[model samples]
Target: VRTVVDLGGVTFMDSSGLGAIIATYRSAQDSNGWIRIAAPTEPVLRVMQIIGLDTIIDCYPSSEQALNAAEQ
Candidate 1:
């Protein structure tokens, strides 16, 4: 269950949104799967970086890159 979330059009996100992602990430890990986030806006990216989400999950500049990484 490899997932790649596209955030190219997302401008804002709150704790609930972050929680959803974290939940999915945990689920993926539990299933021997993975998740990636792509094209996050500056604000969202900053929040993720501040909270170290980027360290735990892979983030890419584009969905294509994310999917490519998932392939490898």
Candidate 2:
């Protein structure tokens, strides 16, 4: 199975959102699955970068890219 978090429409994100993503990531990892983050808005992207999530997370440039990754 695969999981994808589409962030294209999101305008902003706080620590709560970050927390939820991290929790979901952990859950997916534990279950032998993974999540791909897609199309984060500039604001959200900045936050992810600031917190170093960008490096560790599988963040895609677009939703299609993320989906393709899941298929592979």
Candidate 3:
């Protein structure tokens, strides 16, 4: 399964939130699935970048793009 997390509606997130995303990412990896972020808010983007997840995980401006990437 390919999961697209739409961050467009997310206004805020903290360390715990980041942890959850990482955990979910691992779960997907283990299950041979995938997860992607879509349209992350500026604050969330900063945190993701700081954690270096931006380099490992695919982030797209829209869910459509993420899903397309997943297919490839």
Q: After superposition, how far is residue 62 of candidate 1 from its true place, in Å?
A: 0.6
* Higher-ranked by lDDT: 1 or 2: 1
lDDT of each: 0.94, 0.90, 0.88
Residue 69 alpha-carbon offset, candidate 1, angstroms: 0.6
- For model 2 the local lDDT of residue 12 reads 90
Residue 70's lDDT in candidate 3: 85
* Candidate 2 similarity to native, TM-score: 0.91
Give the poorly placed runs of model 3, Cα more than 4 Å off.
Answer: none
Q: Predict model 1's lDDT versus the native.
A: 0.94
The parts of candidate 2 lying over 4 Å away from their true place are: none
By TM-score: ranked, best first = 1, 2, 3
Q: Write the per-residue lDDT of candidate 2 for residues 1-72, one digit (tens) a residue.
A: 367899999999999999999998889888988888999999999999999998878899898999898888
Q: Provide TM-scores for the models.
A: 0.97, 0.91, 0.90
Clash totals in order: 0, 0, 0
Whose lDDT is greatest here? Answer: 1
Model 1 pairs in collision: none
For model 1 the local lDDT of residue 6 reads: 97
